[model samples]
Target chain A: MEFKRLNIVYGHYGTGKTNFTLNCASALAKRGERVTVVDLDIVNPYFRSSDYHEELKRLGIRLIAPISANTTLESPALPADVYSAFSEESGTVFFDVGGDDAGAYALGRYSEQILKSESWQALFVVNKFRSLIALPGDAVSLMREIEAASHVPVTGIVNNSHVAEFTTPEDVLAGYAYAKEVGAFAGLPLAATAVPARFADSLQDKIENIMPVEVLVNLPWNAGK
Target chain B: MSERVLMKGNEALAEAAIRNGCRHFFGYPITPQTELAAYMSKRMPKIGGTYLQAESEIAAANMVLGAASAGVRAMTSSSSPGISLKTEAISYMCGSDLPCLIVNVQRGGPGLGGIQASQADYWQATKAPGHGDLHILVFAPCSVQEMVDLVGKAFALADQYRMPAMILADGMLGQMMEPVVLCEPGEVQMVEKPWAVTGHGGRRPHNIVNSLFLTPDELERTVKERFERYRKIEKTEALAENYMTDDADYVIVSYGACARIAKSAVLAAREKGVKVGLVRPLTLWPFPKQDLIKAAEHAKEFLCVEMSMGQMVDDVRLAISCSRPVSFFGHTGGIIPTPAEILAEIEKMAGGNA
Candidate 1:
């Protein structure tokens, strides 16, 4: 699958959507493609892309976030720089939307511009391990809710399931099957299956559209690792 | 018996609450604790229970008070700042003598602190959950399985004592994943609340659930009676787990997630021929003072290790009555100390004795 000009990643909490977006942006930047990641997540204060401003800058990727994105202040202040993501003529842009319907509403503000954009894909990320959307039917309902709140229909499904650091290739394969069921229920195509970089080599042959992921977002408790 | 499954600490606590007949859960979303509320939101409706996301932590705690007054198992959970918001309702519950469970997956605090694992709320949870001479039963769990087991125990204690009980956990225990053997919903025995205000039906006198005692003398008598019950709880319900303390010369006092790191340090210190043991407090309120005094009998000195900067050390000193020297080692603001660092501290304490 060709990378679109604009990619919007949406998922339930703990589905690893932020990690997926970061890895995707890092890969595009490494390939000499201009990449800008917009942090549209205001619901979850922790583990957002805005916390990685220094890292993202070093990786040659631009990170546009809310006014006080990673600060202690609970401000809903969306920055004016977010408009740059839509106006940029070059570079791949990624939107890390928040986890729930409330978070997706932020994207609805720019829905008209997103709809008129030349090339864009709103990918619904699914992780079967999360308690909220463990079932295929629940995943479909969540996708519909995100679409309704964002005012942008989901273009594809990305199977990015894992049990945190304990994920194995078998877990990824099982999640791929679960994601396929969710894709069928949502009437969306299976865009990619994100595997941990360690397991990418052995599972690449079996899984199509493999998006090898490097875990970048570390929780404070897991800081030592 | 249900099979063991790998689950996050927050999810396990929620499932255990459900198994313990907790049909009502009211909470506002906060980091490190959002998973517990999310799990309750998903599972409560399926079991014909009430799962409400109140507008604020105060509202959620008040909702728990309402549910508990109706004679049902009710719970509310939040992180540090949110827990602070629920204190007013907690005080009300304590004054009214209502039974309810309050889970605090503590994070760095004082004000709007960082969202990370922390034990800084120890003093707040055990000493002063709310204003007045109020005491709430507090249980601290170190592991995911302990989170499940203690949640069931927390509800039981709440019902048995007819007071608010807190499951004092940190973000590390709330977010980590481990194997847990969940109790079957029907298997666990639940305590019945005979004092519940479930309508008199004209057959009995009307029971009113209120904390207001306008007369100062009447309020004093009620508070004194409550303190008598608290005294009995402190005497009978204090719990602690002692590891390798029999022949050790030094003892380390820790609880919650810090104990997990302390235990590893104890084992490593033992391997290096250091006589160190650990006293892990299971209940913080009815703090196992007697057990610590007994441990101090064999040990020369004590060290209190925590994720905060020496909050629980005062309790350790009070437990031992200043008979032995007490030391403290911790990292404040959500920085967890490594086992190696704790082991080095143990070696230093041991070297001082030599």
Candidate 2:
């Protein structure tokens, strides 16, 4: 896998964007990098990177998240520390974007900073298994939607297609062509193929830039794998 | 249908409604249920269906009333406060004997509460959705798949009974992602609505869809007739899941998201040799008193768990005629009660009785 100084991850709501962002943050921190995650998708009440503020901190990551989340006043108010993602410049920073165009609208305010950043790659995650983006064209259109909303152009494509915990190496392989098609459609590179960590070794030779993933943003009640 | 796909509960319900032939969706965007309306906004236009993001929840409900009166499957969904706005129209829809699907993906509430999961709307759905002697068929789904399944079931049953049906989901179920298989057997027969205001021409008499029977006796007659339908629903439509309750001493009663947590607690209690099981009601309005009463014959006590302070506990107590002690354990204001906390409550009840 390649590392950029700043990574902007965006996708349709159920396309596993938050999971990938959290995984990348944890991976970067584990590599002894000073990692900070800008949780810009405050509108999403559940399964956002901000929900893992404690978990991210435990993993030696700094999180600039929404202030009034889960409170009586759940306004999508970003913290003042959000600007530090670009200003600090010492470590890797990731923008865990909101799900869709509506979610991406929040990032429009920080477009100038995001554009001025030295090295940033907006990763458009595509899940073929998800309902809306079952086609490569749909995936590319959503990428454009996010880009239009945030005033930020997407730079890469991530094939994060899976059927939740029931994902298989074959499922990951089956979605490879769809990912490549999406990348081709968007004129972008296939940034990474997110393979479930358990099946990553078996699928190592089959896929390039294999980013092994684990299920983290799961409901507490849905405990078993 | 064969391949399961990961879908948020809101999206699944919206898709399920479309699959069940509900071509009209009118709603206002409200968390954590905005996804459902968003889904409809994207899909309905493509499928030649009507998807109107109304100016307000009141407007949305009125649009649904309009759609249903045309003898079409129609739906409207909202969160707690938005649902409150729609309640007046819900009452009118019931008064007119219109069939439609109303979805309340509940958030914490007394007024404009936080955007998080809470089952506080139990009484609102079951006892009084609006006013008058009216009871909308309320379906409480426990899982994302169940939420999808209930959309079809609710629509079919609503048409069959000529009354509105509600899917009383909380934010947890609305926002959570799960692998779901959309199942629409499409076998259930819908009763014909000859009374629908479909605009009969000069050849036939015009049908009027009105709630105002100005004369008290006429209103009373309609109310009694609606009650007769309610009695039939109570007799036939109550749905419940009895998990490991065949010989359990302590039975846990729950519905919707609380049922999922309570089932987990029941499993944990069983590991400690606690004779505990769960009775989860799928239909909250029908109340499933028969299952509760059946459990009471064998179980010595019952525990009612909820995300609210404890509204459903009263229904549980009433259901079993207080034959056994019905205790309540809950958390309110968008806080979900954990399995451990419920197990602790069950253990205390188990020991207190012993």
In order, the Cα lDDT scores of the candidates are 0.88, 0.88
**Deviation in angstroms for B280 in model 1?**
4.0
Q: Considering every candidate listed, which one attains the maximal DockQ?
A: 2
Least well predicted 10-residue stretch by lDDT in candidate 1 chain B? B1-10
Docking verdict class for candidate 2? medium
Q: Best TM-score goes to which candidate?
A: 2
Instruction: Summarize candidate 2's per-residue lDDT along A51-118 as a digit string, tens digits.
Output: 77777879989888788754546676888878777766648988888888888998899889878877
Backbone clash pairs in model 1 (N, Cα, C under 3 Å; residues 3+ apart or in different chains), count? 0
How far residue B326's Cα lies from its native spot in candidate 2, in Å, is 0.9
**Can you list each candidate's DockQ?**
0.12, 0.55
lDDT per residue, candidate 1, B264-315, as tens digits? 8888889888889999999999999998999989899999999888999989
Query: Where does candidate 2 stray beyond 4 Å?
Result: A70-72, A88-90, A222-225, B184-190, B352-354
User: What is the TM-score of candidate 1?
Assistant: 0.82
TM-score of chain A of each: 0.96, 0.95
Candidate 1 lDDT over residue span A1-225, tens digit each: 457999999987668888899999999999988999999998766667897898899998989998877555667778887888987654899999998888999999989988999999999999877755778999888888888999999999999888776788888898999999999888889999999888798997898999999879864333333
